[model samples]
Target chain A: MFKPELVNTIVDAHQGPDGLLTILHAIQEEFGFISEDAMRQIALRLNITRAEVYGVVSFYHDYRTQPVGRHVLKLCRAEACQSMGGDTNAAALLARLGVDWGGTTADGRLTVEPVYCLGLCACAPSAMLDGALHARLDAAGLENLAQEAL
Target chain B: MRIYIPCDAAAIATGADKIAAAITAEATRRGVNAHIIRNGSRGMFWLEPLVEIVTPQGRTGFGPMTVADVPGLFEAPATHPKAVGLVEEIPFFAKQQRLTFARCGVIDPLDLDDYTAHGGFAGLAHAIKLGPAGICAEVKESGLRGRGGAGFPTGIKWETVRTAPADQKYIVCNADEGDSGTFADRMMMEGDPFSLVEGMTIAGIATGATKGYVYIRSEYPHAIQTLNTVIARARQAKLLGADIMGSGYSFDMEVFVGAGAYVCGEETALLDSLEGKRGQVRAKPPIPALVGLFGKPTVINNAISLFTIPVILEKGAKHYADFGMGRSRGTMPVQIAGNVKHGGLFEVAFGITLGEIINDIAGGTATGRPVRAVQAGGPLGAYFPPHMFDTPYDYEAFTKRDGLIGHGGLVVYDDKVDMAKMARFAMEFCAHESCGKCTPCRIGSTRGMEVMDKIIAGQEPEKNIALVKDLCETMKFGSLCALGGFTPYPVLSAMTHFPEDFSKAAIKLAAE
Candidate 1:
C-alpha cells in the first residue's frame, strides 16, 4: 500500500528551498500519514538526512506518523471555547466515547484531537470534522457530531 | 431576484451551505428568477447565514435562517420572521467604522470585476504614481502599527526593507492567526482576498520585492483555498504578474499552508518554517527587515496590516491618520467573541473604552450573568478585571496597565469562570506549543503547569503562588519569543486579579 514512486513524484513537484512543508503536506494528503519509508524517500530526494526530515515532521503538530481513523474531529480547547463550557462539553464527549485526547474510537471510525483554535470564537466551542467546521457546540451537539463521525 | 449568502467559514459552520442549497431548490420550484451570490461575512456572526436580497431601498437582510425558512423566502419577505431590515442600517453594523473590511460580506470574494467595482485596485493604481519613497512615507505618516501583536510602525518596517541591499528580496504575509478569539484575518482572507493580494503587491512594489508568500495556518483551509483561487485569478487578469495594470511593477504571491505549530506565528520562527526548518526562534540582531527569508531583505507583515495598506494609499495618509487617537492611527477590526452577546468584529477608531465595547456594544454576557473579566488581545494578553474596564482600547493605554491590545481580540468571560484553572491552561498551552529552542520556556512551562496543579490540589497554596510568580519572571525575560515571555501575563494577571480563586478553600469549593 506504501508507494515509493509517489513520494518521488511529490518531492520532485516541490523542488526549492521552501518545498519541504508543501511536499510533506502532499505526501500526507495522499497517504493519510507519513510512513517511515516515505520519510526516508523524502530525505534522499531532498538531499537531507532522515533525522532532519523527522525533526521537521515531528516539530509540527499537524504532521502525523500514524494513520487517523475514518474521520478526524478536532475540538477547540482554547480560552474562548473554554469560557463557553467547552471543557465540560469536551469532557462529556470523551467520557461517552470512552477515549481521551488524541484517542481513536474502538470501532476505528473516529479520532478526537484538541486544536488550539479554528478562528470561530464568535460561535464558541468549535470543532472541525474532516476539514468542515462546526460551531456553538453543546454537549448534545458534540455527541451528535461524534455519532455522525462514527 | 438577487440573493446574498456568506461563504465565510463561520457562516458555513452554521449551515450556510445547506441554507444556500435549500434556497436554490425553493427558487427553482417556485419558478422565481434567483441569482445567488456567495459573499463574505459581515462579521455579525450572531446573524450568520445572514441572507440578503437586493431591494429598491437597499440589501434587505434576514438570518440565522434554516432550511425550513427557505420556502418563506419565495413568499412575502416583508412578513418573514427572520427579516432584520436593511443590512447596512443594522445597529451592530452601522455603529463602527469599516476601512479594511469595507468590501467584506459585500462582494463575491473571487470576482475581480466586483472587487475593482468596489474600489479595489485604486490603491495600487495610486501607489504606482506615488513611487517607492512616497508610498513608504504615506504609510509612515498614517501611523499604522503592526496589527499582528507588536505595535511597530509599518512605514519604518517597509523603509528598512526598501533600503536593505538584496538581489532577491521577499514579502511574507503572516497569516498564521493562531490566537484564540481572533478571526479578522480569517474573515478578510475568506471574504476580500484580493485586497490582501493587492496589499502584498503594493508592498512588493514599495520594497522592490517581486515574490511574496502568504503563510496561512492549516486550520484555515477555507482562507487558503480562497487565497489560492484569488491568486490564480489575479495572475490571469494580469493584476499579479509582471507589469501589473501596465504599471511596470512585477509582484506575485503564493499561499504556503503552515503545518499546525502555534509558535510559527512568530516572525523569525515563521521565516525558519518558511525555509523548511523546525520553527525555532532565531535571535533578533539582524531582524527580518534587513536579513530575512534565506538571508535576503524581507517585509513580513500581519495580514490585517498589509490589508489596511491599500485603503491608506487610496484615500491618502491624512485621511487614515485623522481617524484614531494619539499615535494609534487608522481603525482596528476588533474581534469581540466568547461568552458575549452580539459577538462580532467591530472595526472602529482606537479610543473606545473596554467597558463601552463589552457592555454597550456587545450587550454584555450571553449567559445573562455579570461580566467577570475580559482577556484583551490573545492568549498571551493579560486578563483585565471589571474595575479596569475604563481602559481605552489603545496600544499605550493597555501597555500602561501592563497589558497589550495584541491582535485586537477580546475574549469576554462571565462570572462562572474559575481564574486559577484559566491561568493553569495558559501555562499548559505554552508548554504544548513551545518551539523548544530555549530552556526557560521549555522547562518552566511544564513546571509552571505542575505548580498550578499542586496549588489547585490544595497543596501549599501561598508557596506555590510565589513560585509561580518567580517562574513567570524568568519566563517573561529569559524566553526567546513572546510565546514564552507573554505566558506570564495570563498567569500573573489571574493570580493578581482573582486572588481568592488560588486559595485552598476556593479549590475545595470548586471540587464540591
Candidate 2:
C-alpha cells in the first residue's frame, strides 16, 4: 500500500544504478515491507521490468515483501551460535512462545526470525530485537527479551 | 571528568545506550560535571557496556554495566564491583598488537579533532606527498595482504589498479562480513570510521581512483550509521572530497548497503550488488583490480585490508613489515568467538600458535569443558582438533594444515559439540546462501545436506559418507566462487577430525 507521493519522493532522491538499492531502502525504511504495489511502482519509475524488481525482493533475506509484527526478534542460528547451545536455547524459546520460525505472536506484538549471524559470535547465541543486538542469550534471557518487547 | 561508554551495536544490544542515558541523568541530578563520550568497543566484548572514566591512570574500566549499575558507578567508580581496572592494563587488552584497531575504543568516532590528535589522517597526509607510484611501492614493501580471507598481497592489487589505464577508476571496500564468527570489520567501522576513510583516501591517491564505494551488509546498521556520519564530517573538514588537504587531487566515497547475501562478500559478487543487481558471483581472469565496479579499473579490498593502509602509510612500510611470521606479515585482528571464556578481538602478529590463542588469549572454553575443536576463518574454514593446536596463525601455516586464516575468525568449540551436526550446518548454510548461479554449489550443497542427514541417521553410513566426500570434491573444483569452492573445507575437516561422530553407531543428529 505505497502512496503515489511516497513513490515520487523515493524516486526523486536517487539516480542511476545506485537508485534501485537507494529507493528500495527508502521504501523499506518508510514502511515495514515492500508491497507488491510498491514493487510495481518502483519498476515503473526505474524503467525496469516488474519481474526484475520481484527477483531482487525475493533474492535478498533482508527485503521482506510481507509486513512483520511490531517487534522483530532475529536469533542467530549460525555455527558460532550452534557451538554455544543456541539451537537448544532457540527451540525452547520458540516452544514457550508457541510459534515456529518466521511466526508472529497471536497478540501481533512480536515476530521471531532466524538470522545467520549478528556478528556477535564472541558472545554466542546472539539475538537482535528491533535491530538492537543482544549477546550471551539463554532461555531466561530470551524470555526476558520477549517480555520487554511485549 | 570524562566518561566513555561504547555506543557500538554490541554495546547498545547489551543496554549500553540505556546505561549511557542513566549515567547522564544521574550525573546531572547529583551535580557531577561529567562529559560522556560515545566511543567504539575496545573489542573486549564480554565486559561491554564497558564504562571508562578518564583518570590520571588512563581510562579506568567498569562493565557489563546496566542502568542499575549507573548510580553505583557514580558512588564508587574505582571500587565498584564491576570495575575491571584501567582499560589498557586489562590483560586482555594489554597484550594486543592493535595496529589497525589502535584507536577503536580510545577516541570518539565522530570527532575529527580527536581522530587527528590520536594520529588520524597522518596516513592520508603522508600519501598526499608520495604521489601514486611511490605510495604503491610503499604498500608493496609493507608486506600487507588482504584481510578479507584471500591473503593476496595488497601492494600487488594496488599496483595492478594503479598501472591500469582508465578514465574513471574506483576503490571498493568489501564490508560484507557475512561469516558467522567475524566482527572485525564491524568493530573497525563502528569504532574508528575515520581510519577507514583515511585508508580509502590513501587508496584513491595510490591507484588514481577518484571515487570509492564501501559495500556494507544490512546486518550492521550501527556500522553504516557511523561510517556515514564520519564521512560527512571528513568532507566538511576537507579530509575527503574535492582537493583534499589542498593536494589538487580529488577523491570521494559513498556507503552502499547490501541486502543480506553471503556471496556478496566475494569481490565480484559485491561489485554486482553495487550495480543494483541480485548478488551473484562473476568469473575472474581480468580480476577486479583491472576491471571492477562498473567496468573501470577498481581497487577492491576488505574493510580490514583498507583500514590497514593508513597505518602502513603513517608508520612506513618497514615498521609494519617488522611484525609477524614469514610471508604472512603484519598483525591480524583475530576475532576469538563462540563458546569461549575470553571471547573478544585479539590483534596480534601472525606467528602465534592456535594453542596460545585458545588456551592463553581466549582462556579456553566458556563452558569450562575441554576444548574439542576450533574453526579458524569463517563458515568455509576447516575445523581443527586439539591435536592440531600447535599450528601457527600465519596464512601459509594454516594452509599447510589444510586450514585457512580467513578473516582471522576463530570459533572455539567445547567437548559437548557434535561434529556431525556441525558438518551438516556447514552444508545447510551453503545451501541457504548459495546464489544458484553455479550448478555444483547450488546442487551439491543440497545433496551434501541429504547425504549428511543419512549419515547422521545411521542409514547406509559407509556409502553415505563416501557420497558426501564425492559431492564435496565436486563442489570444491567445479563451483564458480569461494562459496562453492571452500564449502568442502568444513565438511571434510569435520569428517577427518571427528570420524567417530559420523560412524554408523554414533547416530548424532541435531534436533530439528
Candidate 3:
C-alpha cells in the first residue's frame, strides 16, 4: 500500500544487524503490514533467501501474515485474571462477538487476543482495549466495556 | 531526545501509555519538546508506567506513574518532582542480582549502542576468549540450576550435550512458560532481548551447536515480536551466523510459537513442537541430552536458566555460588502476582521467607482482606496457609515442605476463596489442558475431576471423599510426567490445608 519511495525510505533506515527486526517492523508499519514484495526485497537486500525470511515471520506469533483491524482487545488469562472469573467473561465476550482470541471480527471492528498477564494482579481481572486498561471486570463489566467502547 | 514509554501489556494495564500521553501533552502545553517511543515494560510491575527521562545522570526513573503526575514531571526534566528517586537505587531492582535483566529498562531495547554501553555482550566476549571448556567449567562451578520446575544443574546438562556425539546439535529454549502468575520470562525477554540471545549464544559455544530455537507460547505475542526483532538484529550483525564475534563458532536462532498447550513447556514436547510435529511429551530413559531433535544431542533449557549464564562468566562462579541455601544456589527473581498490593518482580537470594515477601514486600492484598492461601509455583504447585508462611522459598527448601518452586510464581488469594472450589478447579484444569499423550495424564485427570465433583456433590458421603483422595494418589504415582503428577498438589493441599472449607461447602450443598 506504500508508494515506492516510502518503502525505499524505510528500507534505507533499516540498518545494522541489531535492528533488523525493527527495520522489518518499520517497513510493515509504513505499509500497514509486510507485503510479499517487501519480504522478497528484504531477502534480496540482506542476502538471505525468501524462504528464510518467511521462516522468521511464520515462527513468531506476533507477526501478522494478514492485515488486522485498527483496534486490538487483549484479555488477560493469567491465574489472577482466571481466578476473578475471566474464563466465564471471556466465553461470554467471545460468544457475543462470535470471534475467538487471535481472530478479527467479521466487521473488522476489533481483533481479540489472549495475553498471559498484564501484571495488574491487584485488580484481578483485566484487559487492554485498544491499548487502554480496564481492570476488575466481570462478565457484565466486560460486556458493557466492549459494547460501549465499540 | 525521544522519551521511550513502555507499551508492554503489563505497563499498559497499569496506565503507562496514558502517562506517556500526559507527559507529551503537558510538555506541549508548556512548549517543551517531548517525543514518545512506546517500548516494552521494564519487568517491574509495581513501578509500572515506570517512565524514564534520559538525562546527564543516565535514564532517571519515575514509576507507578499515572496521567495525573505528568504536570510535575514536565516541570523538572532531570529531577522530576514526582519521580520515585532513581530506579537503580530502588530496592526492588537494587537488592538482588540482575544478570539476565541487566540492560532492561536501563537501555533502549532496540538500540545496540545502548545495549553495549550497559555491558550487554561483554560476557559473550569473555566466553569467546575463554572458549567452550572454560565456559563449561565456569558454569559447573557457579552451581547454577534450572530455574524452571526441575532445578537440575544447568552446567552438567550443557556438559552432557557438549560431550555427546552428534552431527547436528541444538540449543532449545523452553519459553512456552505457561506457569500462572509468572511473567518474569516475558518481562525479561521483552525489556532485554539481548540477554537471552547472549545466553543462548553461550550455550551454543559451550555445546558446539549451530542452531537454536526458542519455543515461546502463543499467549505472549509481544514477547514473540520482541524476540523476533532481536534475533533478526543478531543475525544481521553477524553475531548469530557463521562466525559469532569472529570466534569461528556458527550459531543461529529462530522462534517457534506454541499453540497454548501447557504441557509443551516440558522440554521434550518443546523439541517436538520445533520439529513441526504435534507437541507430545516423550518419556525419558534416553533423556533429551542423548536422543533429541532428529536424534541429535540437544541442550534444552528454561529461559531464566539460559539467561543466568552470562553472570556466571562476568562475575566468577564462586561469586554466583555464594548465594542461596542447600542445593539451590544464586539469586532468584520472585514474581509475586494476584491480590498483592506491591506486586512486582523481586530478585532475592534463596533464603527469603514467604511471610516477609507476602506481608512486607507485597504489602498484602489490595482488598485489605485476610490472605487465606498462597499458591507457590504454578497451578500444579502447593497452596500454603499462614503457618507455612515461615517456610523458605527455594528449590530444595520447598520440596522439604511438600511444595514446589515452579518458576517462582507466588499467587496470593484472600479469605473469601473456597478451598473445595479451588480443588475442583485444579482437577478441572488438569482434565482440560492435559495433552492426552500418556494414559495417566489423559485418563487419570478426567477421573480426578469426576471424583472431586462427587466429593463436592456428597454422593456416597465418606466413600466419595476416600475415592477422591485415592484418585489423587493414583495420579501422583502413575502419571508419565509432571502434568498429571503435580495436579494433585493443589487438590490435596486444598483438602489437607483447608478441610473446613470443603466440609462446609459439601454440607451446605447437601442441605440445600
Alpha carbon lDDT of each predicted model: 0.94, 0.90, 0.77
Q: Which stretches of model 3 miss by more than 4 angstroms?
A: A1-78, A83-123, A128-144, A148-150, B1-4, B35-42, B54-63, B76-83, B509-512
Model 1, global lDDT: 0.94
Tell me the lDDT of model 3 at A48: 74
Screening candidate 3 with a backbone cut-off below 3 angstroms (N, C-alpha, C), the clashing residue pairs are A17-B233, A17-B236, A17-B237
What lDDT tens digits, residue by residue, belong to model 3 across residues B293-329?
Answer: 8778999999998888877777778988898888878
User: Cα-based RMSD of the predictions, in order?
Assistant: 1.2, 2.0, 7.1
What docking grade applies to model 2?
medium
Q: Write the per-residue lDDT of candidate 2 for residues A1-150, one digit (tens) a residue.
A: 569789878888887876787788888888898999999988988889999999888888888788889999999998899899999999998898889998898899999999988898887888999988888888788889889998
Q: Which candidate is the best by DockQ?
A: 1
- Each candidate's fnat: 0.88, 0.78, 0.26
Indicate which candidate wins on TM-score.
Answer: 1
lDDT at position A20, candidate 1 = 94
- The ten-residue window of minimal lDDT in model 2 chain A covers A14-23
Cα lDDT tens digits for candidate 3, A14-131: 5544234555556655665677887777777767788876765554344566777767788877667765567679988988888887878888878887765554554558887765
TM-score of 3: 0.83
Instruction: List, residue by residue over B1-512, the lDDT tens digit for candidate 2.
Output: 89999988888877888898899999999999989999999999889879999998788989889787889887877679898988898988999998999899899998999999999988888998999999999999999999999999999999999999999999999999999889999998999999999999999999899999999999999999999999999898888889999999999999999888888999998888899988889988879888798999999999999999999999999999999999988999999999999888999998999999999988999899999999989999999999999998899989998889999899999998889889999999999999989999999999899989988888888889999999998999999999999999999999999999898344443232
